[model samples]
Target chain A: MLEVRNLSVSYRHTWAVERVSFVLQPGQVAGLLGSNGAGKSSLIKAILGLIPCASGAIYWKNKPVTKQLNKVAYVSQRSQIDWDYPVTVEKVAMMGRISSTGWFRSHSKHSHLLVRQALERVGMWQYRASQIRELSGGQQQRVFLARAIAQDAELFLFDEPFNNVDSQTESIIFDIFAELKAQQKALLVISHDLSETLENYDKLLLLNKKLIAAGSIETVLTNENINKAYNRYLPVGNSDQRGFPSLPLLTNQKTPELQKSTRC
Target chain B: MLTWLTEPLEFEFMRQAIAIGLSLGILSAVVGSYLILQQMGMMSGVISHAVLPGISIAFFLEINVAIGAFIAGILSALLVVNIQKRSRIKVDAAMALTLTSFLALGVILITSLNTDRINLDEILFGDILGVTSSDVWRTVIITAIILILTKLFYKELEFYTFDPLGAKACGLPVNLLYFGLICAITLTIVASMQTVGVLLVMSLLVGPAIAAYLLVKELDRMMLVGSIIGAVSSIAGMYGSYYFDLPSGAAIVMIIFGFFLLAFLFSPTQGILTAPELKNKVFYWLRSLLN
Candidate 1:
């Protein structure tokens, strides 16, 4: 449902993300793996049309991305949001409908139902009236997930939604993603939790200033590939090594346990 | 108390003074809530001072003072917003730059206008006792219009003030909402200048709202309490000025200052000096050590 061609983004004199390219089909989740300041955020920002792109083109569902903006939904990193803001959970979730609802008229009843369903999906309906500041870190992350659900778009871009959330919340959020995939939606998730990302996503885009590798988890997540892209030492059986499941490196290991059980 | 109130109502000047004061108070309190929420108290102060030049220019041109002040306030607000967006200058420094330069221009304009017959005291220190019936009606009508408009766009305004980025992501025109807020603030300041002058107008614009902020958490309740405080303080100051022969503007400002101080010391949740735990072990230890 999405394709990118020769995308390059830079800030002033520094080249952040360079010469990146990939394609994502419907019902697929593409995981992005990179270190700090490795240009992941910049690429996402460029995709969102926030930053001026130096060079690149993006296609969403057979149309140019810039022309099909309303069809794209993004859940940005939670750190950019101010927790002390006076907005409520309901209002945040309803925000996703604004682009689609147009400017003058009030949101339609259908949009309201969608928002309610989105909240239900993330188990945040009880907190609808609650001020966003009054929620725990995990609940707050769930609120953003609900917002993305409310967008009801064909593609989803989640930027580090798992940061600061607990394991149970993360697992619950991944369940929501499974439902989205069932509906034939494409997802690009930027996560630091490489183990969860590798086990869930169908494809992995290993990036560090460039497109180090882009393919199935096994082919792209090898120890050699990660070492080449990151230039960092990784001890065998290290948690860091386990972080982005390089499938080819673990050929003898069974397929992802959760995905395997669920598929069977 | 009824007889005392009826006696004051009988005098024509006293009646007009009360009417004008009440109108200006309501306008200030309503607009001030949004300003305080957006942390734009300094911006309001800057705009209020900056309007002096526009008024002075209007005086020289022999045009209406309100129009000039409105134009000045809007123009300065635009300049400040633009500078903050385009340049690397911080908000505080940008506001200071805009306010000082415009105020300096106003000083120069006032000096230039001094060649003609002009009583600076009348404008600088308002004469509430001399407010004509036409002026009183003007204040009331303007206040009513502003209140209606505020009510109409209340939700959008609240959303914009609380979360600009979220609003933008939702495809709301964040820039337009911000500019609209500045315009509302400008109109409020212009209406208030008739009763409180530029230097003391802040007490009306920011004082009651801040006092209400200290006391309440909800936006709607804060606005209601702010308006009440504004109205009550206006009446008290007007009466005090009549009895003690004080400057009406200064008296009203002092009263609002007193309210702010009292609220600061006694508010339930956020009060500093009069908190619930002031008598607890923490305070006792600090006091004992100091002694």
Candidate 2:
């Protein structure tokens, strides 16, 4: 299990995230949804200790998250990576074993096996020798997914893994997410997607610089929560009328209920 | 051709100079592969020039000049990091500020102290033929240590440089690794200062690595190929200097640039004139302009 208590991240005197609190239980896939500049990435970075938290704490397995970082796996936004870096797909996957292999020592046979399995699982084994820059966007995402799988960590945090990925890659990702969930690992995924893909996550956490709602998908994606988080007036609605709760139309636009509502 | 090479070996100073050049060539290229990959190639220029103040101070204190250069190089890098971290200023601006300040201070100290023994021209453009045997040995030792450490920490360094956030998430000590890299770069500069001097050392560091980068698909191979290029360029440059009466450091830099130009135009995979993609683009642009 992973827990965050009163977490706040500020940059130079301005607050990017303010007193947000949430808990992610094992065997659960929680989707973090918010509009642009909503502090979603900031919250994730703070949790990983990539950025300092203004006032809060993160705990994993009843210990400080910072103390047990080896148990956490993070895939940053694809835009953050240097795609032109000179590395093969297999080498990138093998990087997951660096911490485990330790300093001044070569990777063990088991580590290599794990890396191979990860590449095969992601259907990138054939392209193992290819340079990373040669792969398409979807293939690149799969390669990073392979890296995360090779890490073999208890907690996984993905930032916008679905961005720029093809539909096939999307299904592959959800399938792997299901497998990780079945193994009782905790997962938190930050995404801007609000399609039927919401069905893949067990829970949803709505945010706009603060925690707007946190609960089951139906409970968290309510009309009021969407209005509050997105600052757009959504018509009042119940889960039964919409089949499943979806954010209402903002401004002069017609509500999603009036149009063809996307169903899972 | 063999006599041309063998004749220079007759002189003890010439022999020492060749040994030092070869060692520095390999060391600079290996260390420089990381610098260019990180897109901090200019950081080498910053650190190299930053060593001036340290050398002047060391001369005043009667201590090892290399030690002073190393310390000053590391401090300047740290200063750049701190400046970027503490403010909204970007890294390039911070580097520029630190590079100039240290260089200016070095000049002031050198002139104010009246260090007649210190040669400004030699420091700017190295006197490779004047190197002693001890200098040769020092360059060799630094080369060996750097190579061994690079081998030992290859995986960790690769991960850290490629994706710092991912590496940090996996519990790698990224700060320690970064500091180690900076130290390696500083030591490389110190070693090359006697061969190429401060001004032209950037070519020795970045030239071969970039040339290899154009043709290679992986970091290890890039480093290996870069080392070969560095060694050849160093020896060829030395020979050119011996026969053509050109400055030794300038000759080496020119040779390295010559190799870079060859790779740029002829590399099978990424060559401007040779690669299909680039060739078509160039032709298209030319046709459009003409029509």
Candidate 3:
């Protein structure tokens, strides 16, 4: 279980996120929902201690998270990674075990086995030897998912994982989360795809710079609450929106020719 | 060339120079690979040049240049790191301030000096052909020690460079690793100044790593390739300089630049300069349009 109370993050003088608070119980899948620049990434970074917290405290399993972080694992946005890096998919997955072995120790056969199993689980075993840059956007996300699977941590933090991934890969990854949930591992996912999160996550934390609503999906994702959090005077047009916007959908402005490829 | 290789061992200076160049190439390439990956190219340049003022001060006091250079490099690196920590100043600004100001200070100090005990030219452009045996031994010892450190802490360095946040999360002492990297880079720059000159130290620092990136797809392999290319370039540049009456440092830089240009033209993955049909067609169209 992870608990954050009054968590805040500031970039210089600007308060990017303020007085944000949320909790994820063991065996529960929690979704962090927000629009662009709404502090979803900031909150995630604060939870992982990547960025300094301005105020308040975070606790993992009742213990302070300031010093103890071995229980947590992070799968950042795919864009954060350098795809042209001279690394293979397998090598990237092995990085997950680095937290456990403490750099000096050689990667044991057990670690290699775990990496292979994670790749197989994600159906990325075939591309294990392929260079990272050669993989498609969805494939790159899968490779990262494989790394997270190798981490085998109790708490998983994913930031915008389904950005460029296909539904098939996304479903497979969500299935892994479901399995982890069955095993009582706590999962916190930051995703813009609301319908998918509504279907998969047990609880939702609607946020825009601060906590808008935190509870089960039914209680938090209401039209009124979303509008208030999103800071828009008008409604979002549809109560039960079928499909959330994908990255490719946004790229329609760049080249109108690419819109047809994104429809499927 | 084959006969010279066999006979070159007889001459002690040749042996010493070879050992110095080989070790320096190997160590610098190993570290340079990581530096390139971190996008800290400018940081390395800053640390390298900033050491010059430290050397000048050390020279005035008749102290060891290595000690002075290390101190100066570390302090400059710390300043850059701290400024990045506190201020909203971009890293480029910090690097520019530290490197240029220190270099200018070194130049002013050199101008103020009256003693013939230290010639500014020697420090600025290097004296590879005039390297003392003792300097060669010192270079060898330092290079070996650095190589050992790299091997011993390869995993830590890799993790820190690839993902500082993750390394910090794992309680891996990210700051210590960062400090260690700065020290290693400082040592390389100091040792290499004797051969490549302080002004052109970037050739050894960036050349081999960029070359290796062109040829390989794994970081480890890239390091190996970079080390080999650096060694080969240094030796070829030294010999070419010997034969053609060219400046040794500039020759080395030119060789590296030539290889970089060649790689740019021929590299399969990212070479903008090397694609065959695209280059010809683009140039032809450009010529026609201009006409």
Candidate 4:
């Protein structure tokens, strides 16, 4: 179990995220949603200790979260990587074990097998020797997914993973998330894809600097809450429809399935 | 023909210079590959110039110049990082400020000291023929230390260089890794001081590494190929300097540039003139001529 209490972050001395609280349990997928500059990335960075939090206490397993970083696998945004770097997919995937492999030592056979399995899971084993720059955008995302999978962590935090990804990658990510949840691993995904895919998350966190609401999809996606999160009023769905996920945005697809009910 | 090669080694100074040059070549290529990957070429330049103030202070206090230079180089690197952390200025802008100010301060101190023993020209352009046996030993020790540490930390350094943010989030001490890299680069510069002075040191650091980068797909292989390129250029430059009485530092830099040009034009994977796109056009043109 992971518990965050009153987490606040400031960028250049101005508060970006303030008094945000949340909990993540094993075997669950939580989605972090917000508008541009709404402190989504900032909050994640604070939790990871990549940036300093102004005031917050993150406890995991009844202890400070910092003590248990070994059980955490963080997949940063694709934009943060250098594609032109001279590295193979196999080497990139093997990086997940660097800390555990210890200093002054190379990866053991066990670690190698784990990387192989991770690459195979993402269907990227054939490109193990290929340079990272040669892969497509979706393929690159899958490689990063392979790295995270190889970590075999209890908690995985991914930042904006599905941005501009192909449908195949989208399905792969969803399947992996489902598999991880089945394995009792906790996942926190930061995404802006507000289509039917939003239904995949077991829970949603709506944020606009501070927490707007936190609950099941049915409770958090109310028209009043969405309006408060995006700072613009949106049409409300049927009030009694509390059992299923709501498609909040209309995509380029012409399918009438969600064309009228979802708009961002 | 053999006498030309054997004659230079007869002189003790020539032997020391050659040993120092070759060792410095390998060190610079290995360390410079990291700099090029991190996009810190300008920072290397900044540290190289920023060592002057340290050298002046060392001379005034009668301490070893190399020790002074190492301290100054590292100090400049830390100052750049500190400035970047505390202000909105990026590393590039921070380096620019630190470099000019340090260099200006160095020139003033040297002038005020009125020391005729200090030759500014030799310090800037390098006097390779003046290399002593101790300089050769320092180069060898620095090379061994750098190579051993790089091998020991290859995985962590690779991960850190490829994706710093991801490495940090994975519980790796990324800040320490960054500082270690800075220290490595400063040590590499100090080792190379005898071969190329502060002004042209960047050429030694970047030229061979970038040439290898265009040809190789792996960091380890890149370092190996770059070291080979650097060693060859350094040796050839030594011969050219011996026979033609040319300035050794300028000769080495020019040869390094030549090798870079060759790689840029003919590298197997990414060469502008020898890639598949150009190969097909050239083959078509040859067949048309025959027809």
Candidate 5:
């Protein structure tokens, strides 16, 4: 299990995340929802100790997260990577074993087997020799997924794994997420997706520099919570009767489905 | 052709120059591969110039100049990192500020302290033929140490350079790895200061590595190929310098650029002339102009 207590992150004296608290239980897939500049990335970075938290603590398995980094796996957003880097898909997968193989020693045969198994699981084994830059966005994401799988960590954090990925890659990712959850691994995914894909997550945490709601999708997707998270007030009917009030929540630009629904 | 090469070996000064040149060639490329991959090629330029103040100070203190150069080089790199982290200034701007400040300080100390033993022209352009036997040994030792360290930490360094955040999350000591890399780069610059001088050292560091980058898809292969390119350029440049009466440092830099041009124009996978897409684009443009 992972726990964040009164987490606060500041950048240049401005609050990015203020006093946000949440818990991620094992066997749970929680989707972290927030608009742009809503501190989702900052919160994740702070938890990973990539950036210093203003004032907060993160704990994993009852120990400080900083001391338990080996038990955690994080896949940053695709845009943060330099695809032009001169690494083969196989080599990138092999990097997951660097810590386990120890310093000043070559990778063990067991490490190679694990890397091969992870690449095969992601259906990227055939392109193992190709350079990373030659792959499409979906394939690139799959390669990172393979790397995460090879890490064999107890906690997984993904930032926008679905961005720019194809539908096939999307299904592959969901399948892996289901497998990880089945194995009792804790998972937190940051995503902008507010479509029917919300059903895939076991829970949702809505945020706007602070935690607005955290629970089952139906409970967190309330009209008032959505309006508060997005800072938009629409005079639509009561959200109770609306089932899943899929208001054009974050992006401001309405989805085609939302436009059709609004017409009715 | 054999006599031309053998004749230079007969002279002790020529032998020392050749030995130092070849060692520096291999050393620069190996260390330089990381510099270019990190998109911090100019950082090499910054550190090389930053060593000037350290050299002058070391002369005043009667210590080994290489020690001073290494310390100064590392300090400048750290300052650049500090400035970028503490403020909104980007890395390039930080590097520029540090580079000029250290270089100016070095110049002021050199003139103010009357370090008559230090030759400004030799420091700027290099005097390869004047190198002693000890200079040759120092270059060789630095090369061997750097190569061994790179081999021992290959996997960790690869992971750190490719994705620093992911490496850190996986519990790799990325900060230590970065400091180790900076130290290696600084040591390489200090060693090459006599062979190519600080002003032209960036070419030795970046040229062969980038040339190999155009043709290879993996880091290890880049290092291997770049070392060969570096070695060849050094040998050819030495021969040209001995026969044509040109400056040795300028000759080597020219040859390095010559090899880079060849790779840029004819590499199988990425060349402007060899890649099918670029080749067709050129032909199409010419045909349209003719019409």
Candidate 6:
């Protein structure tokens, strides 16, 4: 289990993420949804201790997890990596074991076996000797997924992984996430798309600079909540009524309700 | 051909120079492979020029110039990092800024001190012919140290260089690795100051490594091939200097440049001249235009 309390991240003088707090239970698949520049990456970075959190604390299994990076597996966006770096797919996957293998030592045969297994799981075993840049966008994501799979960490944090991937890759990743969840590993995934794919997550945390709402998919993803988070009049009604219920507009809440009642 | 090579080694200075050049070549190419992979090839240029201030300060204090140059090189690298952190200036710009300013400070200090003890030209261009047996020994020691460290920490260094964030997330001491890399680069620059001189050192550091990059897939192989290429360039350059009376450092750089050109055009896998894709594209374009 991971606990984040009153998490805040600031850049220069202004706050990018302000007073956000949430508890992620073990064996749960949580999704962090936000718009562009909505501090999603910043929040993930803060939780991972990649960037300093201005306020609040992060605890793992009731112990301080910040700076204890070895316990976590972080798969950054593929765009963050230099695809042109001179390395083979197998070599890239082998890096996941470098930390566990320790200093002044080469990777063990067991580590190599894990790397091969991870690559095969991601359907990338055939391209083990291929340069990383030669892989397609989805294939590159799979290679990165293979690296993460090889890590075998307790907590997995994926940031915007669905971008530029095919349906097959997407399904493969979701299956891994489900498998990790079944094994009771905590997972936090971030996505920008607002589609039915959000249904895969057991819980959702909506954000637009702050924690707009966080709860089970049914309660937190209400149309009213999304409108408030997206700050747009999305005209989303309840899922029972119009697929997903719309949030009451803060600007003219009384009018929409009155119109609904009159129509009823 | 044996005498052609054996004739030069008969002179003690020539033997020392060849040994120094060979070691320096291997060291620079191996280390330079890291630089090329990191895409910080120009960093060597920055360090080589930045050491001038340290040399000048060392001359003023009557200390070993190599020590001073090493200190100055490390200091300038730190300055670049500091400037990049505190301001909007990116790394390349910060490097360029430090390169010129540090070099200028060194020039001013040397000129103002009016010391006849040190000549700036010798520091910038080097005096390979003037290298003593002691210089050859020092190069050997530094080369061995670098080679041993690289072999010992190969996994960690490769991880840190390829994907620093991933390494950091894995709890590897990435910052320490980065600092160690800087120190290695400084030591290599200092060790190399005698043969290539500070100014021409970049050719040794980057030229051979880049050439080898075209032919290899792995960092280990790149380092090996780059070392061989660099050693040949340096020794041949030394021979060229002896027979043709050219400046040793300049001849070495010219030879390395020639190797780079050869690799660029003829490397089997990726070379422009050897790859069929370029020919196919040219023919296809001509056919389309004619149609």
What is the C-alpha DockQ of each candidate?
0.20, 0.77, 0.53, 0.75, 0.74, 0.55
Q: Residue B34 in candidate 1 has what lDDT?
A: 89
| Segments in model 3 whose C-alpha atoms lie over 4 Å from true places | A236-264, B4-10, B111-116, B268-291
Give model 3's DockQ, 2 decimals. 0.53
- On residues B71-116, what C-alpha lDDT tens digit does candidate 1 reach at each position? 9999999889889877778999999999999988887888877723
Candidate 2 docking band: medium
Clashes of each: 3, 0, 2, 0, 0, 12
TM-score of 3: 0.90
Top DockQ: which candidate number?
Answer: 2
Residue-level lDDT for A173 in candidate 1: 86
Clashing pairs in 5: none
Worst lDDT 10-window in candidate 5 chain A: A255-264
Model 4, residue B19: what's the lDDT? 84
State the iRMSD of every prediction, in order shown: 3.3, 0.8, 1.9, 0.8, 0.9, 1.3
User: Would you list the clashing residue pairs of candidate 3?
Assistant: B265-B273, B265-B274
> What lDDT tens digits, residue by residue, belong to model 2 across residues A60-107?
988999888878889888888999899999999998777777788888
DockQ of 4: 0.75
For each of the candidates, the C-alpha root-mean-square deviation to the true structure, in angstroms, is 6.3, 4.9, 5.1, 4.5, 4.5, 6.5
Model 6 Cα lDDT, one tens digit per residue, A1-264: 899999999888788899999999889999997656778888888888877889999998887876567778888877678777778999999888887888887889999999999999999999999988878988998998898889878888988888777789989999988888999999998876555666689999998889999988778867677777767656543222332223322222222221121000
The best-first sequence of candidates by DockQ reads 2, 4, 5, 6, 3, 1
* Model 4, CA-based lDDT: 0.85
Error of 1 at B163 (Å): 2.5
Whole-model lDDT, model 5: 0.88
How displaced is residue B142 in candidate 2, in Å? 0.7
**DockQ comparison, 3 vs 6, better candidate:** 6
Over 4 Å off in model 1, which ranges? Answer: A5-10, A62-70, A99-109, A207-211, A223-264, B113-142, B214-218, B258-291
| Segments in model 4 whose C-alpha atoms lie over 4 Å from true places | A236-264, B277-291
